[model samples]
Target: MNIKKIMHVENLTHFYGNQIGCKGINFDLYKGEILGIVGESGSGKSTLLKCLSGEISPSAGKINISLDQGGVKDFLSLPEQEKRQLMRSMWGIVHQNPRDGLNLRISAGGNIAERLLNVSEKNYSFLRNTGKYWMEKTEMDSDRIDEFPLSFSGGMQQRLQISKILSSNPQIVFMDEPTGGLDVSVQAKILDTIKSIVRDINVTMIIVTHDLAVVRFLTDKLLVMKDGIVVETGLTDRVLDDPQHSYTQLLTSSILQV
Candidate 1:
């Protein structure tokens, strides 16, 4: 059984003037698959995620996405308007900071409704109901649908952000440190909710994090990066259990010591 390939990235490189952001990155993301990019700070994992999610343009490389409309298109080649349309309809991004992804002044349900609106959902009743449904689905209380995001706890805000993104039923979701800065217990619950939602929705996801435990618990495949390069790429268990690269070995060993 050949799994459908949802994205193909080749020789992806980015530069910040004289500095390298990420270099020669390559990977294929398949439908319903979860891939993690892990590295320490300044490893360029975040830069790579930004490039992949269209937050920034790569200095060079090809990112081809299999479109639902029935063909592959170079994501980097699309017009700005088209890129925005694709992002609005088919791709979702969850930022490390929930505030970055959400509108703090809006009601939780309104935040979700805004995404639905972008996808051309016009019925007010359906939008409200969908928001309520997604809130519950993400383990958030539906009763707080009318509350502003600022009133929610950090964990709840993150869950609300997830609800807003997933409410549109996007084909791909890019998460940058989804559990970052939260309490360990909060992170655990969010991770569990994320895992369950991904499985339930069968949506493809690419996550960037420094936590090996996050990859171990949530990712099917992993990429270990150092100095803007992918030093190792393999199944999560294989890479963690028996890392071949020195950097990867160091990463795995550090996790073991903790």
Candidate 2:
């Protein structure tokens, strides 16, 4: 059985006034695969994720989506309410800044349960138990889950963000540098936690990061970009070891050799 493409984009183009965002963007994310996007700072990796996650709309082209519910829909053209429903339950996004994405004053449990409340809130014990379970799944202490987000370390907060998003059980995950600016050891541990958790649930993920090490560890397919256009895309091992494009070779070389 062929896994229908969960997400699809064709000839996607965007603009901020006269500035080009990305043109001719095309890709398909299959079920249960980690698709990694890597590019320089201004290369539109973040922009593309935003588009896919419905945070922003593209200026042109179509985003066709096949929901698990047996409904086929076009993303770029949807009623605002329908879009909201899709985003709230079907798509999980972890922005680059953990602080920007989460409510800092809310207890970590509240943050995770926020989306869970969307379905049904009649059972309080079950909600709390689910939240507590994910905190442990993220390797976070259950005792600290009731603490405010501001009280946790940066890495811990990122895990909270993941837990919050995952609690909703989105079919597609859009993660922007979920493990950046942390100490190497912490980054490794966080990646390990993410890898384990996402795999166990068989979730589809698209992570945009400049870190090649992250790409190697978290993804099977690699998409490389520069100046808002994809230069190369292939299996992770091939793209990293024997890149076909100059930009991809440069990116592969930039990684710290083991």
Candidate 3:
């Protein structure tokens, strides 16, 4: 893939009062690339997502995003309404739990169609057609489109959550622990499903995960975090196969040991 920075962060810092979550993080996410973040808990992985998404503004630094309009803007400096609009159509965040991402009361298709409702200058027919197209693309059977999220298995629910976000066609997708809490076999399937979707659609992804094995399966590049800081980052193969930073080496070693 031709490499260019889709999102750039420089001098990035996040603080909760006196305690820092992540400090001076500089990185770039390329188009059609899967960037993995691997770190132990409390390593500021989730905090970075919050900062980037504008859910909680960063204490300091610049986040520049290339807009579809052929312009760039500081995502951190945007007005509240503008940021909210950006999130509704341009960006997506998938939580660790499928249930957390989906509405239990709604059918799978309703959950997938929520994005269209948020920006519905279009008619009802457009939304319905779009929903069914995405459902089929995500490997969801047509009959199950009307089923409640509660009725699906964990893996199925996760696929539905994926379908929900992909239907919006976000420029970037940030996933927090995409395979957490599932057994090894189920986790692998989830990872494979996600990889297939991203490859098919060519969306950039930033995945924060504790599981290095999943990272290997899903990401093209990597960033290793330690104590609210980025210790290292590079091509996934380079970092895992031959890490330079001590902390990164330690992380890869532990994963290899397992």
Task: Give each model's whole-structure lDDT.
Answer: 0.94, 0.87, 0.85
Estimate the overall C-alpha local distance difference test score of candidate 3.
0.85
Residues 98-196 of candidate 2: C-alpha lDDT, one tens digit per residue? 997798878999988887887666588988998999899999999987899998988998889989889888898889998887778889999999999
Residue 171 CA displacement from its true place in model 3, Å: 0.4
- Report the Cα lDDT for residue 103, model 2: 88
Each candidate: RMSD? 0.9, 1.3, 1.7
Q: Give the candidate order by descending lDDT.
A: 1, 2, 3
What does candidate 3's lDDT look like per residue over 82-115, in tens digits?
9888777788888889998889999887888888
| lDDT preference between candidates 1 and 3, better one | 1
lDDT score, candidate 3, position 101: 82
lDDT of 1 by residue, 1-258 (tens): 888898999999999999999999999999999999999999999999999988899999999999888699999988899889877768999999999999988999999999999978899999999999999999998999999999999999999999999999999999999999999999999999999988898999999999998999999999999999999999999999989999999888886553
What is residue 204's positional error in candidate 2, in angstroms?
A: 0.4
Name every residue pair that clashes in candidate 1.
none
TM-score of each: 0.98, 0.96, 0.94
Worst 10 residues of 1 by lDDT: 249-258
